[model samples]
Target: MTLSFDGTVIVPAADPDDGERTAEALVPHLTPTSSVIIVNVIEKAGGAPDKASMEQREKHAEDIFERTRRPLQSTDAALETDILYGTDIVERIFAEAQDRTADAVVFAPREGNRLAELLTGDVARRLVKEASVPVVALPQRDV
Candidate 1:
């Protein structure tokens, strides 16, 4: 039987070091039949980021998506990228999952703050708790 999933992966604007590894963690579980959506949640500010800042952020997001896309293709799954703007990432994630009817939501967790994260949920933990769909959170790997 071909397992199908309408899954949405939240690819936040990640830094260089561990972004590759975090993306790799999500690849194996995604089959060819999965409808993969790569979501980049933009932070909505009182005033939008300046042109240079905006361009830089968008470029960073695009790069992360590019790096992430390569591994999933081996599974014969295509990745679609989307940008969402909201003040809070957790809320944006929740809304996207509900709107897309996503079966699963994947995210690369922020580094460190492990204990504080569990005690006082940051974006990933909070989203996992409140996600309309199941949230698969991947932590950054130790080098």
Candidate 2:
């Protein structure tokens, strides 16, 4: 089957490299007219949080977006960035996807220890199970 994405694509930007890697991997599938929305969610901790830490998190997220956008410069794909704060990461992503009227959701499979997966819950697995739009996970690879 020939696969392609044209409308807004919701990309999970969990790390600096995740977005870059995902864009590169999708180069073959995406057309020059495609637009990608790179999103990073900072899971909020319960209870009141300090202002300084929150500011720091936002700054760091901007840095990640800058780094991620660098590699995608070679592609004709239009890029957009979003930094979100929420308790449920997956839900936040889904909400953004729906609000943006995304044609698909793309993510780079994050490798974690079994214990980590059990503790935090696997995002990739959960997305596959519940995503309303098509979910595309690029094959795992070393950075």
Per the 3 Å backbone cut-off, how many clashing residue pairs does candidate 2 have? 0
Best by lDDT: 2
> Which 10 successive residues of model 1 have the least lDDT summed?
10-19
Q: Write the per-residue lDDT of candidate 1 for residues 12-77, one digit (tens) a residue.
A: 434433346655666656666677777676676657654347677778777867776776667766
lDDT of 2 by residue, 1-143 (tens): 87777767988877777666776676666678889888888888757663448777788788778877876677788988999878888888999999898998897777678899888788878898888888988764444
- lDDT scores of the candidates, listed in order: 0.65, 0.80
Which one wins on TM-score? 2
